[model samples]
Target: MGLLFSKFSSYLFPNIECRTLMLGLDGAGKTTILYKLKLNETVNTIPTIGFNVETVTFHKLTLTVWDVGGQERIRPLWKYYFPNTTTLVFVVDSSDIERFSDAKEELFSLLGEPELANAQLLVFANKQDMPNAKNPAELTEILDLGSIKNREWFICGTNAHTGQGLYEGLMWVKKQMKA
Candidate 1:
């Protein structure tokens, strides 16, 4: 049977699959980060109204990442994509300091979802290349990342424009997935 073959294939190949959800407020660079990870190049992106799914291989793990629309009207759709998600990658516009509270609220709300209760959290404090961008330490404070409990989580500073800190983030995700 199919189950036996799946188990055998997994044992022989050991290529694990991780379902990851990438989310953020509108204009937070979630699409940019997804493409950068998928293509290793920056591609022009408009607001994602529905979602973008891409499979990225990292350290023997195949990450099927879902980058959903973050606009207020579309945010409600995010929950429909939450089931079976193994990792939640949140991209934040660190330079847009005015929206830190909004980001924190949305992040905590998503974490509260029962479907994603087992999901590991990876927070990308993105736009770190901008002069006004907040650093990872500052973002950790503003987002109140320390208050997160019952889930493994990490925060990394990143610049999707030049592809900095993205792989480091993936490395952490990979470790968490393996654990």
Candidate 2:
């Protein structure tokens, strides 16, 4: 069964290369999620200053992920990396209710960019392990994801500390990319 599935996946998504951008507010755990995907283990990460790029192979897909700094001072530079991005993974601090509006603003701004008009969006409600963490449904409502149209988008409650929901999110992106 394993071999059969492997062959089927390879046949369907042969050497597919996807460029994914990880963007969100600072302290949203974007870097943590990137390291979890790349290393498959927890690792300490400081706030990203500019950006960090890494590639990881998931199933039959090769994803080149660019995790850019989410600080206010660095947002202007995000446009420079928008070109050719196949997926946009926007991480949100599920426990941080104070910055939901900030995240919504940034997300809408990014979606408005012509360069990313065709990109698929995967919103990660990170820090789900926290006691006060919001679920994906609530986050979606708060972010007004329902209003989005004419683009592919998904939201998953993720806990970067234990790597939960990370693979599922990636798999969703992979499937969308295939479509």
Best by TM-score: 2
The regions of model 2 sitting more than 4 angstroms off are 1-13
Q: What global local distance difference test value does model 1 have?
A: 0.93
Cα lDDT tens digits for candidate 2, 67-101: 99999999999999999999999999999999999
Query: Over the stretch 1-179, how does candidate 1's per-residue lDDT look in tens digits?
Result: 99999999879879778999999999999999999989999999999999999999977789999999999899999999999999999999999989999999999999999999999999999999888999999999999999998999999999998989999999998787677
Can you give the TM-score per candidate against the true fold? 0.92, 0.93
